[model samples]
Target: MEKEFNGRDLKLGQIQDGNSDYTRYHITYKSGDLTISGIMNIPKGIPPEDGWPVLFLNHGHIDTSVYTNGRGLRREQDYLARQGFAVLHSDYRNHTQSDKDPNTETDVRLGYVEDVINAVMAVKNSDISSLSKERFGMLGHSMGGGISQAVMVVRPDLVDAIVLYAPVSSDVVDSYNRWTLRNSSNAEKIRSAHGSPEENPEFWKNMSPRTFFDRVKTPIIIFHGTADESCDIEWSRETRELLLAAGKRVELVEYPGQYHEFGATFDDFMKRSSDFFKNNLK
Candidate 1:
């Protein structure tokens, strides 16, 4: 019999007998006296002499834990572990179970990158025998994709390969405006304008992935839905173009007629993503 896990098809009940133990940890990081909370998932597998390839996964924009618990135990981290990779997933500051600092609103702009860096450090320094600091990969979605780009620039030594899904593009000003118009009502738009791009040009520029493309040397795989309304497909195309122009290794896969979440075909997305990571991370 066959079973499905995290939207991926796999053999059912194929239990490998061994000392396999998985643990969830609460990690704290300090950013100038501000502490943030994050979750770490360590899988049970043969202890590699050096270290197993680690994948640091960043979730999309959400205040709850649902984004991290996609398909329950078949979550991204768990799925990666089943594939013999150690995975680390974290909640950004002021989101989910993480610490809520009073200055979060002001510091949120840099929260994603900070959280990921802290997560990587936590895994690298942890006592997990199967985790090595030398072999690491990044997997991010939506807002996390933007964060991944920033991570590649800030911590290039910590990441080996990257996989971005529905990433935000360099045309942030226009994209944000379009998002506001399509998703928010006039009243909501008026309220959002308080922190609009015009007012936060620096933040937009600093966080835009396109600004640091030349600094990214890690190979990348991008997945985008052609029919995505939330984040335009042009972002992925532009990113691909930039990476290719720089003589970097980048692969892009487009899902035709797919919407924001890519509908119920998420299984297909994970399969392709897993293959991409496997091929690139090795």
Candidate 2:
């Protein structure tokens, strides 16, 4: 069962000050038996003659569109809207107000990527007047970043470019292994049901962006905090190195002493993110 929030009156200004050209709406995209819910932020005040760029924004693990909405990232979305960009930030199946599919919800990670693809397709095919699919990009944070990478490998045509914040590195198995060891109880339970890194090596390998770097041709910009404790800075560094080695277009930005969710700050994270979109989405 899915509970929906239209957020019809959800003020973008609640997150930050920006032009009033953006309006937020909730959408449901079909994925097999599942109905995935998402938030679409469309830039207003533009004539139908002008075409705007589109960006698919994905939230991190254990997070939702509500968090992004409250944390002022929606303001960043509004800022992009003011700049003539349409942003769709979505909640993966089983998270937040999204519906859960019994078949995929049990494996949350894969469901996240599927929901991302669904969101992108929904935005691309939506009847909404404010969105344009020809100019498309993807922006994601943490686990969402990892999903963005996976999406690039499978559906690069849906996106022209990507911007990742504190993205999880390509070595997903190792990362999960370390995480499992540190947080034994919960990790073990998930592993027991979903299979451990060792048991499901193929799944981990397929999901890893590092392993599929050769398949990625789209330009990518990745940001990470060197002091990040959750996902670690080494992951970003390794990804950067792999992408560079593959002769792919990649830009890596590292912030010193910043931890996970460094972008929660209104000025620092929101401003930098908006700037990145402005520069690359052009």
Candidate 3:
């Protein structure tokens, strides 16, 4: 069973300096009685008239054994903050200090999606002086990109725009098969516990963001590498094609021969991302 999350009654504390221009805070919120912890970056200066526009950042999966808070995409967070935007990145359930959600294979990443949505609600109703309630955006990388797509379908009004980095496939069955083939041992364990995607096609279908693209109205931009070995570049291309076919506002940026993280083109990617958010949110 899934836990119901209330976006109201959010609590934030344990503030620390992210940098000279931004402060990071410890976020404590409810995803149906499970306590989740995350980091929020706020600009030090006075907020704009309505309030400072904020971005809710979603990070891809990391092995929880060594995962720590703010582990994913700190560079991007810092850049976004320095560029005068407030950023919030959730550790997600079971990662870092956040409490764990029940594990399931069929649902796969939906619980993480719920955690991100809960973070969105928490930020929307939060009392942070520097965060604007009306203007909001999202950025996700890899698995996080997949989460972002799912979130857009579930809560289209939560964010004004979204940017994806080397996202995984929206087809849950494909993702499962690919993952299983890559790590057979872990795959067997997972399958034994939750059943294989082949045994549960309907569940996989229900869990896919592609199934709900019609509900997604948020404008989107995606960046992927042609030489990526982790997640096939085709996943992103297929996603972009699907969104276009659905008549949704979307764009895809491809970097030739770049790896999954865009190590060589991080600067260019950040510049385009910053510009996209600035144009859409500000």
Candidate 4:
């Protein structure tokens, strides 16, 4: 998993105009044999000597069929870019214009992790004069946060810092109970093929990021709202506890009355997020 994913052959499509602080463009980067589509935002000013420090933005779970390029993290894309960071928001495989992944449903979507790792490599290998080459920061929301967790464990040095906003559990067993088998009809298909979490602890552990938290070198800060109904705040609490037990650098900030998506507290949240990346990423 670490030897490859050197992102290559980046292609930027037509420019998107509207924002005043940064320039937006549609883009594609190689992820294995697949061509992943995404959106990028470059701040509309001169980059620092080492180029703009980057942020790999990962979005929450949206129905893939209806998802568009940079759909879920538009606010972050713009907000982070305007604050002088190059933002790469991947749509992941089989979403938006990315190539289809035939094994997505059966597999645990580890391919999404590949896409992000490759995205980091793409920026590192690109000829863009304004992209950073040092350790980058990543921000993931909800299911995307789960993917970022895998990214951290799979390649600890790939990203130096991570911000998880109302993330899902790092444990696959918890995830399976909360999402996969909760109200979905795919339980039989999953159990028939790979057995249930209770029936197959090893399989679930192999699929979990918590199993590899001891390998994580990235500094992480998590933000969760008390009233987030879609994803319980307890998830982040448990995740932080596990990370702390592993002796990892981590912090968890709980908003007293916020929800799944930050509303009244978004500005303050972004401010802290901005500071976290600035203080951690090199």
**Top-down TM-score ranking:** 4, 3, 2, 1
**Which tens-of-lDDT digit does each residue in 116-188 have in candidate 3?**
8888777777776667888889999988998898888888887889999999898877777777557777677
Model 4 over residues 221-244: C-alpha lDDT tens digits? Answer: 999999998888998999999999
Model 1 stretches astray by more than 4 angstroms: 1-32, 64-74, 178-203, 263-265
* Candidate order, lDDT descending: 4, 3, 2, 1
Per residue, candidate 2 scores C-alpha lDDT tens digits across 165-249 of 8887777776576654676765766677767767887766765767778888688888888778888888888888888999999
C-alpha root-mean-square deviation, candidate 2: 5.8
lDDT of 4 at 217: 95
Instruction: For model 4, state the Cα shift of residue 19 in Å.
Output: 3.4
For model 2, the stretches where C-alpha displacement exceeds 4 angstroms are: 1-19, 47-50, 63-72, 103-108, 178-195, 263-282
Worst 10 residues of 4 by lDDT: 181-190
Give the TM-score (vs. native) of candidate 4: 0.95
Off by over 4 Å in 4: 1-3, 182-185
Give the Cα error of residue 207 in candidate 1, in Å.
3.5
Judged by whole-model lDDT over C-alpha atoms, candidate 2 comes out at: 0.67
Model 2, position 274, has a per-residue lDDT of 64
Q: What TM-score would candidate 1 get against the native? A: 0.76
In lDDT terms, how accurate is model 4? 0.88
Tens-place lDDT digits, model 1, residues 148-182: 87787666666788988888775555555665355
